[model samples]
Target: MPMTVGALRETAKGERRVALTPETARKLVARGLAVIFEHDAGREAGFPDATYVAAGATPADAADVAARADLLLCVQLPPADRLTALRAGTAIVGQLRPNAAHDRLEALGERGVTAFSLELLPRTTRAQAMDVLSSQAAVAGYRAMLIAAEAAPMFFPMLTTAAGTIRPAKVLVIGAGVAGLQAIATARRLGAQIEGYDVRPETREQIESLGARFLDLGVSASGSGGYARELSAEEQAAQQAALGERLRVFDVVVTTAAVPGRPAPKILTAAMLEGMKPGALIVDLAAESGGNCVATVPGQRVNVGGVTVLGPLDLAAGAPLHASEMYARNLLNFAGLLVRDGGLSPDFADDLVAATCVNRVGEKQPQLI
Candidate 1:
């Protein structure tokens, strides 16, 4: 019998992205994998039931699909209760944040379900096609600038009229990563004069290539996996002292610095916020992991000293169509490692499979966590 894979509609609050898309589903079917999806699974992402059908997928309610499939794909970790219903040994795959969901992860092992967290995929050229974090961060970065522009009182670009000339909005983007670079590019397109900052010195070239000046704080923390290593207390204090003063000069500030599986470091302090001009905007893309700003409330917008601080959650979902498409491609490529010749292969010897597999066949791999 062909291996069956199913997708459930995401139940996470404000999550609109679907793990499967019509195009990806068609590709899976072409590989002789049985594709099943919950009814209306793709609706929120602008894909209709008819679209999935045309792409050769079966649609049914969650319960029916859950019982029959040997594997399940999801946008986020599905709720514990829904996971409990999956048949034992079914492989579950998605961007499961195991660090935060330790309890639910244990529950999956207890239920005898094999779980794979794509977030654990090793940073390798072979795994680039399955890089969900980079794909989604790119979307969030582009949207962060739009959110800042909409919330700011002044226009992004300069203007010349019968009245006196208006200067372009000055923007600062912290974290010269995929998201930060995108934010810088987007802000520039809107005619804003933008600058970027990062703890890693190597990113200066990437930032400058995007037409934004790189703000160097005279410290470097380059780390493995292309991520900045955690800064020491002395380094953090130095960075804060220098950054707080420079932050006051920008009309808009976007902070995207985040370390996976850890609380986001506080980059903007209350004193710094007090120094900003009235009506200046700060968009914290790290809101979900605590936030880059001290005052940030996840999923809420707050006003501090007349300056607006916007912390958007699930920013990728705000632009779900393309987000879902990119996410689905990543999932399809990752799943190919598990499915072979029309049935489950479950080869842990494969580096990509070994790194991503959290639990398999009722055994929890604590070392991987």
Candidate 2:
């Protein structure tokens, strides 16, 4: 008999993406996995109950889906209440933030449920298909640039019109990760004069490849995990001074610096905002984990020294349909690696799964908190 997999309705506030779509359900069915999904799980994201039914999945209630599932899949981490429904030995896969919610992970471990966090997948060439963070951040970066462009008073492209020639906006992107690189490319496509800064000296080629000048502050604070490491107070001061000096010339700034388990580093100070041209715009993508800008308030827009700062939370949720599609593909790739021969065979020996799996293994205690 095949293992039973369930897709529960997303309970996270403002999260509309379903864990599985009808098309994905059909693929699982063909692979000999029984699928059960809560009725209307995908409705808000434009997939209807009838669609799942046509794809050979049973439309179940939330309780039934949770009770019957041998494996549960979700977009966000399950809430405390939902975690209570899992049977011992049940496997759960999703974007559970273990670093941010160690207590919740401990609870799941106590319940004897195997949990996997998609974000912890290593950035290896073999794991590219399962790279949810990069895929989602790509969309976020593109959208953030558009948001900044719209909010700014000046035009992104230089226009030689009959009335007068409008100068192109200057855009500065901090952090040359997936989001930052996408922001630079998107801004350049809009004809903006783009410049990018990063603690990783290796990203200089990447920044220049996107037609953006790479701003170097002579810092070597990047980590082995290919992320920006925390900087020393003295190094931070030098970075701040260099960044503040550049702020005065840029018409739009987008900050994407973030450390997964820690608060976002403050790269833009209040004084930096003061130096920005009047009516300038700043989009801080790290708002949810504190912000890259000191003035940023998550999910709110603030004005400082005549400059507009937008701290948008869950930018991926803003584009539900496409976001769901990309996320679903990532999950499917990950599941494919673990599920084989009509049963769950989570290969702990596999590097990708070993790095991503976060819950208790066998009788061992959880690795996190």
Candidate 3:
């Protein structure tokens, strides 16, 4: 018998992105796996039950899908109560944030459910297609730039009008990762004068390619695996001093700087907020990771003095349609590793499989953050 894969409607609050879309379901069904999803699972993301049915996927009751699934796919790990509903020895794949889900992960381990957390996947050229983090970050970045544009008191594009000549908003995006690059590109498309900054000096070309100038603070925190290393205290102090002076000229600032498994570094201090022009806008995409700005409150928009500061959470969820499509494709590529030819034959020796598997059936393992 072929392995059965299933996805449930995401129940997390403010989460609208579905794990499996009909397009991906069709691909998986063609791969010889039985695709099952709860009815209305993709409705929130614009895929109705009829679409999945047309794609050769069966719409089953949530409980039935959970009971019969040999492999379960998800966006976020289900809550503790929902985890208890899953059968033992069922393999699950998702961005199971083990770092923040100690209790829930413990439940899965106790139930002897095999769990794979994609956040632990190795960063390599071969693993790019299966990179959920990068794929979602791109969506978040693109959306954040739009959020900044919406909140800005001034226009994004320069205009020569009959009334007056209006200049474009001067925008700065900090962090040159996938999110930052996407933000720069989006900002450029919106006709903003953009500048991109990152602790990794190597991102200058990327920022420039997006039609944005690279802001250099003369501090480099380049690290392995394409992530920036934590800056030393002295280095941070120097960078902040330079940034404080340079940032005052921008009409908008978007901070996307974050270190995986760590609290976001404070890139914009309260004192720095005072220097920005009145009515200036700030979007902190790292808000969920404790924010790169002093005034950021995750999921809130507030005024720090006269400047508008927004800390929007789950921007990818805000753009659910394409985000779900990209994320579903990411999950589909990852599923390819486990389902070889037409059967579940995951090789434990494969580095991608070994690194991402959080726990094996019947055994608890030390999970990384």
Clashing pairs in 3: none
Cα lDDT, all candidates: 0.89, 0.86, 0.89
lDDT of 3: 0.89
lDDT, candidate 2, 267-311, per-residue tens: 888888888889899999999999999999999999998999999
- In model 2, the worst 10-residue window by lDDT is 360-369
Judged by lDDT against the true structure, how good is candidate 2? 0.86
TM-score of 3: 0.97
The lowest-lDDT stretch of 10 consecutive residues in candidate 3 is 360-369
Per residue, candidate 3 scores C-alpha lDDT tens digits across 46-123 of 999999999999998888888878789999987665655677767789998877886677667678777888888889
lDDT of 3 at 120: 80
Give the lDDT of residue 99 in candidate 1: 73
Worst 10 residues of 1 by lDDT: 360-369
TM-score against native, each model:
0.96, 0.93, 0.97
Clash count in backbone of candidate 3: 0
* Runs in model 3 lying further than 4 Å from the true structure: 361-369
**lDDT of candidate 2 at residue 69, scale 0 to 100:** 83
lDDT of 1 at 250: 90
